[model samples]
Every structure is written in structure tokens, then in C-alpha cells.
Target chain A: MIVGDRKPMDEILEMLEPYENILILGCGTCVTVCLSGGEREAAILAGQLRIWGKKEGKNLNIMEHTIQRQCEKEWVDEMRGHVEKADVVLSLACGVGVQLVAEMYEEKAIYPGLNTTFMGYPVVHGTWLENCRGCGNCVLAHTGGVCPITRCAKSLLNGPCGGSQDGKCEISKDTECAWQVIYERLKKKDQLDWMNSYQPPRDWSTAGDGGPRKSVKIEEVID
Target chain B: MEADEATSTSEVPEEFRPRIVAYCCNYCAYAAADLAGSMRLSYPPDVKVIRLPCSGKVEISYLLKALEEGADGVMVAGCMEGDCHFMEGNFRAKRKVRHAKRLLEEIGFDSQRLEMFNLSSAMAGRFAEIILEMTERIKKLGPTPLRKGVKD
Candidate 1:
């Protein structure tokens, strides 16, 4: 999932200053899974903002609602009625979810409440670490399930860069060498042979060709 | 463990009884605690029970906020491992508890302070025992530094 974390409260407040009626839209999927923009988070942020709004004596109407998946058009479309009534939308979803909201409602303003980190998992409760760059291509097959692109300090496709010292990355003592982790993981799985093959630099087209992008999205195409 | 650092709540509990918080699944753990009440089983009142529809509904931040407010110890009580009013509620709750334990430890709070338990709704005695155990553990640890003046 595309991992994200909330932006500073001041930033959010700044964005909402122009609008009178606001909606704090949340996602129930990936961002929710990573504990970023979810129903619970939406409620909490709403409560907090309301308290802040009251202290400032500003007449702010902040409504909180969560969708099943903000990335999906169908889910976003459900809010058309709600969206039309609000002056601006404060999306708690990831970056994609924000874009989708923007796409869904062209006339209204949409703002992001999260800083859309990298794709990661919950290392533990409330803790998230970046794992995937979502370069549009996945290379998990060669790296023994670990993605050096995201986990490695250098995003090295090859084995540990010489910066590793005593199994730790030179970038930081606390961080483990991604290549070493791959080595051990591959060894455990008896897939070290996969590492012997060489790979060239990753293609950037899938990452940032920097143009209007479109996907086939076969499932969404109805007869 | 990461949640503590992430939520920035761990540092808030610098001292005191370390307000203990528990999220109890209304179907199981809450009922168990009620059973303890009926049975007259005694446990410390420092721990506050926040009833949840299911442990699954309790988010990581919910627990973090509790700890930030000086909850010295936290626990999530759910239905038995195999039985949940909402399938996998306890399972997810357990995962959350484990993650919370790690987060608390990462923030300098003892990981033991956050715990997860699975019990049948009928097992009230077990609930009292768990509460007593958690209270004793927190008492030994003393007040959480953050809780010394947490806003609540």
C-alpha cells in the first residue's frame, strides 16, 4: 500500500483557512491498513480540529467521513452529494486518494492531510517503515523477498555496497545492510542462485515518466 | 515500539502511577471484568477500561494516546483465540497488542506494560487475575514520567 503520514496541524489549518465548510475524507483501505488515513484517524483529527476551531472562535464546519477505498472511483463517487456541499475537501487518504478526489470533483478544492511517505508496512503498532517505491515494476523475485530499492540505503540492485560495516549500513549504525539481509534471506530459502544473475539499472518509466498516465484497468471496464 | 516514537506520546509519561488503560472487547474481556465485579475480585483502580466494540476497532493511536496521558500499562482483552464475535477481531487485536508492546519499549517505556490477553466471556476469574497482574507490574515500575502532568 502507499504509506502516508499526516501533515503538520498548522499546515492543515492553513489549507482549510480559505474554506468555511470542510470535509475530512478518510480511506478505509491501504492508508487505513498502515494506520495513516482511516476511520479512527478521521474521527480523531476531526475532534482535534473542532477543538482548535472552537478555541479560535472560527465558524468552521468540519465533517468526517470514511470511504471503503479512496483509490476507487466508485467509492469516491458515493461522496458526490457530500462533496458538492463542501467548499473544500481535506483528504486523509494517501496521495493517490487525494488525486482521485480531485479528479472526481473538478470544481471543488481538494487538500491533502498526509505527506504520502513510501510504500511500507506496520513494523509495529503506530510505526510504519518505507518498503516500496512503487516504481511500477516489482523486483522482489531477485532479492529474496526484500526490496533493496527501498530497504537499502543506496537503493542498490547489486549486493551490499562497500559502505557496509559489521553487517550494518554506514548510512546509519542502527540500520541493517539490506544486501546482507537479502543474502541471509536467500540463503535460508536456498535461492542464492537467483542472486548470481545480474540486473541493469532500473527503468524509470514506471516511476516518473512525468506525463499524463493511464492504465488499462480492465476490471473497471464494464460491457 | 515504533508507535511510541511515532505518536510522540511515550515521552509525555515521565512519572506517576502511569495511568493504566485497557481496551476491552465488550463481548469477552469486558464481560469478564464484569464477572470479576460480581465475584468481588479486587484489582487496582488505576487502570481504566475503555469498552470497544471489538479489539479490532481499537487503533494503535488510541493506545498511544492512553500511554501519553500517563497510562503506565495497557492491555487489550479479547475473546478466546479461536472465538471472536467478529471473526479475527482478537487475532488483529493480538497483532496490535504485540505492535504496541514494541512501540512502548521503543519509546523507553517497558514493553511489558502493553499486553494482550485472550479469554472466554465466561472466564471472569481470569480477567480479575490479569488485572491484578497488570496492576502489580505497573506498581513495581512506578509512575510513568509522561503521565506526571498529561492533559488527560
Candidate 2:
């Protein structure tokens, strides 16, 4: 899932200084799963903001709302009434959700409450690790399912670099060399021959190189 | 004027008593509190214990809510490391406690007001000690300024 972390409270408070009626909007999808932006988080932030405002002698009218998915137009539309009531909208969603909300409400001011980190999964209860870069290419078939693009420090396509030492990457002892993992897995599967083949340079066009990427299904469009 | 001055000199300042909310795991800290009671151990009466099924169930929102609702201090008491009945609930709770403490500090409150304690159900004496320690620390810090009508 797309992972994100809430922006620092100081920055959020500063952005909210000029606004009195604030709407803290939360997303119910990926941001919620990552425990960054959810209904509970929205409420907590609202409460904290109120306390801070009271301390500063600034009276604030804060409202909390969480929609199904902010990235989708339908979900963004559902929050129109709340947006109208708010002087400013503090979006506690991923970057995509924040942008979508901004696009949907061009006349209203919107501020992101979270820093969208990466596409990753939680390794443990509260720890998340980045596992994919979304390069718009799948190279796992040739590398024994290990992502060299993200896991490797150099994004090596062929084999291990000189920095790989005893299965560990030079970046840190905690990080395993992606090539070493691929080599070991391929060796176990008796498919070591795949390692002998050389891979060409990766294409950048499909990976949002030229501009923002979009996907559309012509048949599914109602119009 | 002499009589008025004498009466004013005799007046004593009211002691500051902190209101603390402790979220205790039922398997460990809650049971320890009960044990402390059964053993007749003395601790501060300022702490109000709210028992939960596990320490991991203590959410950050709950901690913040306690402070927002007039709690001067908050604590999460869980089992010792690696001894949780739910395997890693205590560990998870510890991380959440640390995060919540940071949040509290950012919100202009004393981070020391929130703490995490690890103890076993059998350690009744230790439970009493922890309560006293927390109370003394809070006394030194004085009442929370976030409390309504409190002066800095």
C-alpha cells in the first residue's frame, strides 16, 4: 500500500494560523492502512489543533471528516458540503488524494497534512519499509522475485556490484544485497543460467519520465 | 490593618494535586494494581486506572483524549518485554507510548507527563513504587498548564 507520515504539528499549526474554520479531511484507504491519515487520526489532530489554538488565544472552529477514498472523484464529491463550510481543508491523505481534492475544489484552499513516503508495507506493527519504486516495469520474473530496482543501492540490472559484501549492501549492514538474494534464490531453483544473461538498459518512458502518467479504459467510460 | 495582615499570613496555599490516567493491561499492570491493593501497599490515590485487554489496545488517540479531557498526566502500564500474554502487545504499546509522548511535547505539554512502565502481575511492590515515583515527578513539575484556568 502507499505509505505516508503526518507532517509535523508545528508546520500544520502554522498553515492553520490564518484559518478559523478548519476541516481535517481523512482518507479511508491506503493512508488509513498505514496509520497515517484515518478517521481516528483526523479526530486526534482536530483535538490537538483546538488545544493549541486555545493556548494561543485563537478561537478555531474545527471539523473532522473521513471519506472512502479521496483520490476518486466520487469520494471527493461527497465532501463538497464539508468543504464549503471550511475556510481551509487540511487533507490527511496521500499525495494523490491531496492533489485530487485540490483539483476537485479549485476555488477552495487545500493543505496536505501528510508527507507521502513510498509504496511499501508494514514490516511489523508500527514499522514500514519501502519495497517498490513503481518504475512501471516488472523485473521480478528474471531476478527470483526480488526487486533490484528498489532494494539494490545502485539499481543494478545484471548482477552484484563490488559494494556487495557477504550478502550485505555497502549502504548498511541492515540492508541485504538484492543481487545476493536473487543469486541465492536462483541457485536454489537450479535456474542459475538466468544470471548469465545480460539485461539491457531500462526504458524510462513508461515510468512517468515524460510527464504525469495516466491509465484509461475506453470501454468502461460511460461517455 | 494588623489583624487583616495576621489572618493573611496564617493562610496556606492549597497543594497541587495532579490528575493521572493510567491505561493498564488486564494481564499485567491491572492485576499488579489489584495485588498491591490486596497486599495493602500504599500508593498515590491521584492515579485513575482504566483496565484494557492488552497494552497494545491503548491507542494514541486515547492518550491524547485523556489530556484533552483534563488529565494532567497519562501512563500505559504493560507486561515486561517478551513476557506479554499477546506475545508483542507490550512492545507495540511501548512504541505507541513513545510516539504519543513526542506528540504531547509538540503540543506544548510536558512530555514527562506521559510514560510507559513494564511490570509483571506478581510485582505488587514495584507497582506501588511506580505510582509514587510518577506522583513525585508530577508534583515537581506542578499542575499541567493545559488544565483550564491554570497559570503558567
Candidate 3:
């Protein structure tokens, strides 16, 4: 799931000072699973805003609602009535959801309540660690299912870098060396020969470095 | 329902009783609470215990919700480190508790109101001590500013 963290309440309060009627929008998908911008989080944020507003005598009117997936146009459309009533929409979704809402409702003011951190899943209940960098290319086949692009500090392609000491990354003793993990896994699978092969340079064009990327399926689209 | 109404109105005490919510893991802390009961240890009645299958099941939202719903303080009691029934559930809960504390501090609340404790089922005495210690600490902190009738 896409992992994110709520922005500090101070910043959110500041952004909301200009608006009297605020809508706290939540996404029911990725952000919900990561425990960042879910329905419960949206409601809590609304409660917090109300407390702050009362303290400051702002007379803020806040409404809380959650959609199945804020990234989809249909789901966003379902919130049209509430959106139109709100002076400003405080989106608790990821960055994608915020932008999508802004694009869909061009005249309305949209603000992000969360700082979209990374594409990852919860390792346990509350701890989320990044696993994918969305580099547009996947090389997990040769690397024993461990992603160097996201795990390795330097994103080294071939093997362990000089900074790898005692199977830990040089960036921090807490981080395990990605290449070391790959090596151990490959050794167990008797695929150690894969390590000797040098991978070619990654294609930058397929990645988002060029520009905004899009995927289209003509068969699924209807005019 | 009648009893609840009586407690809320006619039976209301002049003294302020801090409302506390304790999320205890069923595998360890919950068992310890039961053991404390069997041993006949007396702890504060201010605390309300909610048991979960594992400490990791306790989410930050639940802790925040407790405060939002008028809890003066919230505590997470889990298994000792390296002793979680589900391997790293206690470690995960610790991280979440730390994160929740930071969030509370950011929102201008006393971060000490939220805490995490580690113990085994055998430590029934320690469990009772924790409840008393937390109750006293919260009494000093007074009602949460977010609580109704409490002014900033």
C-alpha cells in the first residue's frame, strides 16, 4: 500500500484558517490500510480541528467523509455535493488523491492533510517500511526478490558496495545491507551464479524521469 | 442504563476522577491484570482495560480516539521485548506508542499522557503498580485540555 504520514496539526490549522466550512476527506484504500488518512483518521482530524477552532474562536464548520478510493474519478464524483458545500477540502488521501480531486474540481480549493511518504506495506500493525521505488522497471528476478532500488542506500545494481559492512548499510547500523540479503537468499537457492552476471544500465525513459507517465488500455475505454 | 444515568448525574462526585484507557495485550498484559485480580491486589478504579489479541493490534488512531472521547490518559501494556507471542508485535507497538506521543506533543497536548509498558503475565504485582502509578501521574496532569469543560 502507499504509505503516508499526517502533516503536523499546526500546518493544517494554518492552511484552514481562511476557510469557515471545511471538509475532511478520507480515502478508504491505501492510506486507510497504512493508518495515515483513513476514515477514522479523518474523523479524528475533524475533532482536533473543532477543538482548535473553539480555542481560537474561529467558528469553523468542519465536516468529515470518507470515499472508497479518492484516486478514482467516480469515487470523487460521489462527493460532489459535500465538496460544493465546503469552503476548502482537506484531503486525507495520498498526494495522488489530492491532485486528482483538484483536477476534478477545478474551482474548489484542495489541500493535502498527509505527506505521502512511499509505496510500502505495514511490516506489522503500525510499522510501515518502503519496499518499492516505482522505478518503472523491476529486477527482482535476478536479485532474489529483494528490491535494491528501495532497500539499498545507494541502489547498487551489481553487488554489495564498499559501504556494506557486517551485512549492514553504511547509512545506518539499523538498516540491513540489501545486497547482502540478496546474496544470502541466492546462496540458499543455489542461484549464486546470478550474482556474477552484470545487469545493464536501467532505462531512464521508462521511468518517470522523462515526464508524467500514463498507462492506457484502449479495449477497456468507451467513447 | 438507569445506573449509568445515576452515576452521571445524582451520584456525580465533586472530586475529579481522571478517565484512563489501558490497551492490554491478551497474551501477556491482560493475563497479568487477571493475575493481579486473583492475588487480590488493589488498583485504581479509574482505568478501563481493553484487551487485544496482540499489542500490535493497538493502532495510533485508537489511542487518539480515547483522548478525543474524554480519556485523560492512555497506556499500552504489551509483552516484554523479545518475548512477544507474535514475534515483534511488542516492538511494533512500542514504535507506534512513540509516534503517537510525538503527535500528541505536536498538537499542543502533554505527551506524557500516552505511554507504553512492557511486562510478562507473571508480573502481577508490577501490573497493579503500573495502574496506580499511571492514575497518580494523570491526577497530577489533571483533565485533558481537549476534554469538555476544560479550558485551554
Candidate 4:
């Protein structure tokens, strides 16, 4: 899942200051899983704004709602009536959910409440970190099931560079050189010979070469 | 309480009472309180009950708003184990209570004041006991310092 955290509440208030009435939308899918932009969070944000606005005598009328999956058009349309009446929408969803809501309501000003971090898993309660870069390639079989490209600081294909003395990476005392992992893994598999065989340079065209990328299947469109 | 945001706590009389919005389920806690009253048992007059269909409908945001509006604390009382008027409403209420505790803790609250209690309607005395207990607890914790001293 893509991990994210809510933007500061101060920043959110600044963006929504112009609007007296606002509808805050929450997503029930990935954002809910990460516990960033969910129904509970949406309501909490709305309540906070109301209290603050009232304290400042700012006539801020706010309401909150959550959809099953704001990333889908079907789910986004469910709150059409609520969205139409509000002066603005504050989305408590991931980057994708924010975009989906914005695209659905072209005229409404949709603001994001989170900064999307990366593709990863929840390590434990309230802790999430990046684990995959989704380079559109899979070389886990060649290495020790760890992608050196993402984990390694140098992205060394076959390494244990001269700087690496112990098991840790040369760049930092904390990090384990991914090449060390690869060496140990290949050694365990009795396939150390594969290490000597130079791997061709990584194909840059397939990996982050252009600007932003997209993953889509025209055939799989909303079936 | 003082949702007006203008009435300063310092300006109020010590005897000035706090208003609490209690969401009590009809099955157990609400009836339990009524039984206490009918039986001439005394309890604090701070709470104003909002009879809810179930404790499950008590969102944490409501609790937060109660506190934000200057209620000393909010207590959610549900049915005793497996005795809900609506099956599993109290169970869902239990989950909401735990989640609310976590949220309040994250936002720098001790969360002891915001609480959930479970009891059967037969335990009217116990319901009265919990209200007294929670109310006393909040009184000791003092007014929510965040909402206090607003420089008028």
C-alpha cells in the first residue's frame, strides 16, 4: 500500500479560509487502511475546524462524509449531492483519492490533507515505511529476494565495494550493504559463480526515465 | 457546556455547573440510571442524556466535540457483555471506545476522562456508581487546559 500522512492542520485551514461552507470527504479504502484519510479522521478534522472557526467568529459551516473508495468513479459519485452544495471540498484521502475527487468535481476546489509517501506495508501499529519503488522490473530471483536497486544506496549490481569493511554499507554504519546481502544469499545457494558473471547495465528507459509514470490497462476499465 | 467560546472559565462561579452530553443506550445504562432516580438514589446533575438507539452510534467525534465545547468529559455506557438491545451494538461500541482512547492519546490527552462503561439494566446501582466515578474523575483532572485561559 502507498503510505501517507496528513498535512499540518494549520496549512489546511489556510487553504480553506476563503470558504464559509466546506465538505470534507474521506476514503474507506487504502487511506482507511493507512489510517490517514478515513471517516473518523474526516470527522475529526471537520470538528476541529468548526471549533477553531467559531472561536475566531468565522462563520465556517463544515460537514464530513466518507465513501467506500474515492479512487473509483462509482464511489466518488455517491456524494454528488453533498459535493454540489458545498463551497469547497477538503479530501482526507491519499494523492490518488484527492485526484479522483478533483476530476469528478471539476469546478469545486479540492484540497489534499495528506502527503503520499511510498509503496510499503504497515510494519506495526501506526508505523509504515517504503519497501518497493515499482521499477517495472523484477530481479528478486537473482538477488536474495531483495531488490538492490531500491535498498542499496549505490544500486551496485555486484558489489561489496572497497568502502564496505564489515557487513554494513560504506555510506552509513546503520545500513547493511545490499551487495553483502546478495553475496551471502548467492553463497548460500552455492551459486557464487553467478556473482562473477557481470550483469548488463540496468535498462534506464524502463525505470524512471521520463517524468511521472502511470499504470493502466484500457481493457480493464471499470468492468 | 460553554460552546459559545466567549464565556471564560475563570469568570464563572465555582458552583457554576458543567454540562455533559451523555449518549446512553435504552437497553441497559439509560434504564439503569432511571431506576436509580426512581429509587431515590442521588447522582450528579451535570449530565444531560441524549437517548440513542444504540451505543454504536456514538462517534468519537461527538466525544471530542463535547470536550471542545468545554464539557468536562463524556461517558458512553452500553449493555453488559452480550446484553445489547441491538445485537453487537455494544460490541461495536467497545471497539469505538478503544479506538477513541488511541486517538485521544495521540493528540496529547491522557484519555482517562473519556470513557466507556458496560452494564445490564438490572445493575442500576452500578450505572449510578459509574457516573459518580467518571464525574469525580473529570473534576479531579480539572478543566481541559487547552480550552482555558483564552486571553479574552
- Candidate 2 per-residue C-alpha lDDT over B84-137 given as tens digits, one digit per residue, 9 for 90 to 100: 999999989998898888776687756787899999999999999998888887
- The candidate that achieves the highest TM-score relative to the unseen native structure: 2
Which pairs of residues collide in model 2? none
Better of 3 and 4 by TM-score: 3
Off by over 4 Å in 3: B1-102, B110-152
Q: Which window of 10 residues has the lowest lDDT sum in candidate 2 chain B?
A: B1-10
- Lowest-lDDT window of 10 residues in candidate 4 chain A? A50-59
The candidates, ranked best first by lDDT, are 2, 3, 1, 4
Candidate 4, B46-135: lDDT as tens digits = 887777778988887887787666666778889887778788999888887887776655444557657888987778789778878877
Best by DockQ: 2
- Segments of candidate 2 deviating more than 4 angstroms: B1-13, B32-43, B80-83, B119-129, B149-152
- Cα miss at B30, model 3 (Å)? 13
- Clash-forming residue pairs, model 3: none
State the lDDT of candidate 1 residue by residue for A1-223, as single tens digits.
7788889776887899888798999999888888778998887677556444543445778788999988899999998988888899999998888999999898889999999988777788777778887667899988999988888988888878899888899989988899999999999999998778888887878875787567788998998
* lDDT, candidate 1, at A16: 91
Cα lDDT, model 2, residue A32: 91
TM-score-wise, the better of 1 and 2 is 2
Model 1 misses residue A29 by how many Å? 0.9
Residue A82 error, candidate 4, Å: 2.1
Q: Report lDDT (Cα) of residue B61, candidate 1.
A: 63
lDDT of each: 0.79, 0.87, 0.86, 0.77
